[model samples]
Target: MTDQLDDLIATVQEQERRLVLTRFTHDDAWALGSLVVGLARERGLPVTVDVTRGAQQLFHAALEGTAAHNDVWIARKVATVRELGTSSFLAGLQARARGEVFEDAPWIDATRMAGHGGAFPITVEGAGVVGTLTVSGLPQADDHALAVEALELFRAG
Candidate 1:
């Protein structure tokens, strides 16, 4: 389990390093959010997607079959990314790798910060992580994968 966590950590770190944008804008948010929605629809995934820069939301969508609770999850995941400046999944993995519970940390509020997968930092070249692209409604790992896949597609174009 430790080895697997370590491997995942490494992979996530690599993703953070490589999946960087030259810049992020409202148009980029729309494109990325649409890509995620398209992919989710293709897979029949019931999910909510959100993109935000600081306190400003750029784009948001909730697919069919998703519930209000999914938005709650999105908020939590986004908060996790905002606070940690890393992928929420990576934060969870790093905590587990250290045999620590992330939410148990004094600075963490379990209700508003989820260490689960699905929220990814929107990193810009030379600007660092300026926002988050988040998804919810699927299993945590799948949600994370969907977000990553969309980011990869957006980066490729």
Candidate 2:
């Protein structure tokens, strides 16, 4: 891997390490979803947020002015998290660095999974990946950062 990609992976890994929760509740999803909306509104970003645990979608919304296509991106990114147990940004980087498209990658179904930014694994302290927090409608990197930002802010709260 390139140094830049390595650094980006490490940065996101650090976030995963720092934000492990002891327990996750439906209430936490609401809290996180609210903060995500706040962050987008604060930045005047047209975006969509989706938070889910297992097959259960807890909170979801698309801000006015966001493209309908963002919902598709959100689903694809969520599939990345479900299958990879890593941030979509990192998986996308891995695919790009390998000179491959995500759909052609063997690990997950191309049609269902996406190797792009905007999705993050929600991990529990000792339970590993339990859910996802995803955002779409910005540049890939920015979408990933927005999800991370909401998690960080939620952590602080």
Best by lDDT: 1
Enumerate residue pairs that collide in model 2: none
On TM-score, the candidate that comes out on top is: 1
Supply the global lDDT for candidate 2: 0.87
The true-versus-predicted C-alpha distance at residue 95 of model 2, in Å, is: 2.0
**Where is model 2 more than 4 Å wrong at Cα?**
none
Give the alpha-carbon lDDT of every model: 0.91, 0.87
Lowest lDDT sum, 10 consecutive residues, model 1, at 98-107
- Each prediction's RMSD over C-alphas, in Å, is 0.8, 1.5
- lDDT by residue (1-157, candidate 2, tens digit) is 5888778878877887887887778999989988999989998999999999987999999998888789888899998888888989888887777778877876768668888899999988889999999999999999999999888888777
lDDT of 1: 0.91
lDDT, residue 91, model 2: 87
Clashing pairs in 1: none
